[model samples]
Target: MEKMPAKQYEMGSSTSTKSMQPQKFLHSKRIGHMDSFSRHEMMYDPPSMESKSMPRSSYFNSSKPWPDLESDESDMENEIDIDNLPPIEVGPHEHRLQYTYWLWFSRKGTHRATDYSKSLRVVGRCASVQQWWSLYSHLKRPTALHPYRDLSLFKQGIKPMWEDPANSKGGQWVIRLRKNQIDRAWENVCMAMLGEQFLVGDEICGVVLTTRSPECSLSVWNRTATDHASTTRIRDTLRRILNIPVSVPMEYKIHCDSLKYVAISKGPLKS
Candidate 1:
């Protein structure tokens, strides 16, 4: 037979046999141990406690405890006790609400309004130095009070007005501050009042702040208007405490004069 031309076979020809791939086998875990495990015990048993060893302080070797260490531990226990204890319910008085009195009047009017009055008002102690601060901090600032409000911290029972028996024969050492000066003047005066900086402490009845259309003034009222020594001492002391200029004169208006002016203004007007 004549040799026919050899046919060229292409790579990946259909005539080529397909290679067989090896199969993978998965082995089962041993079933022998499965019978030993108990699901209920595994799920339900309590966890083991953490292995924290007791400190040297807890060791029973020593009969007495170290003072410093014991104190710290006691403090910690106290803190824990405090934290666990119910919070105390504080009352209004326990919080210490305080009020101050002030005398306010119009120069041209008869009716003067005062925060100081005979009516019983809740006033914290005005006796000691610290008590004064307590009053100041808890009470409203002078400027924050109503325009008609005036604060007078006098010996208890003495009224703030000139008509008071204690104030009848007296006068006031007045310092005039402009409208713009109200805030600073109030602060300075309040500080002076609280600090008890007046020299004639016995002569001083109380302090007053008068608010007017154009200006506001503060005065330290004294029991005796004619007593120059007392007046001079009070004036000098107030000036020093307020750091006012020596040249600035503080006017002394006798309580008598104040009452008279009020009387005349209130008197029936002649037609």
Candidate 2:
């Protein structure tokens, strides 16, 4: 895979100096059912579609840290050959994760404004630490993606969409951060989830990182929206894992609520 040039940023002196230590959360425990070796296929040939580039608006100026839509396409093209890559090797001594996870990618579609799910594709799947790192190291960081692009890490059988059976009754904890702060935050939270640091078994369906101008957001999706105890535990774990201050707000929106909002926003379907 071709490595795209990393975009440099001019950080202002006013940016937060708080350094995050993500290494401390590396502790892992075998928490769920194990998977067979044959289940470790890590790539697929995603259906191709014409790239629809959105015009750069005034909101996306030169000062923004992320690349524009044009540059994002190059990153996408680099990833298109993932399916042709050789399978990742997993040694007998390698540490296996609790559950198999898949890395999915999607960009907002111009024609189907509300149905971005149509663009969702599985880019990688991993059953162990080595497999995960091999795939992750090849992808661009959140800062390199375009505003509407999203990267999701979900359990093997679960889809990242709200409508998925595993996700239909759940919600996500959303946290928005400045562009400079997202890379580490995203890496930490993902590690926390994969390590089962949250301690809520099977509740975590997936985690998503969405890139936008000015700020990027990370959300943790769980299986039960009504389980206050589990939800609260997930939130507290997120704060600790990300080293976020209590003053920073974290919002939890249930999938039902999100579905309703989308339905309302789209209005009634015409005959």
- Pick the TM-score winner: 2
Please give the range of 10 consecutive residues that has the lowest summed lDDT in model 1: 19-28
Q: What lDDT tens digits, residue by residue, belong to model 1 across residues 90-135?
A: 2333321122232222222223333223321222234333334333
Residue-level lDDT of model 2, residues 113-193, one tens digit each, is 577665676666777766565455556767777787889999978989988999999999887778887777777678677
Q: Which one is best on lDDT? A: 2
Q: Would you give me the overall lDDT of model 1?
A: 0.46
Q: Can you give the lDDT of residue 94 in candidate 1?
A: 30
TM-score of each: 0.52, 0.68
Off by over 4 Å in 1: 1-125, 179-196
| Model 2 ranges with Cα > 4 A deviation | 1-90, 269-271
- Rate residue 12 of model 1 by lDDT: 19
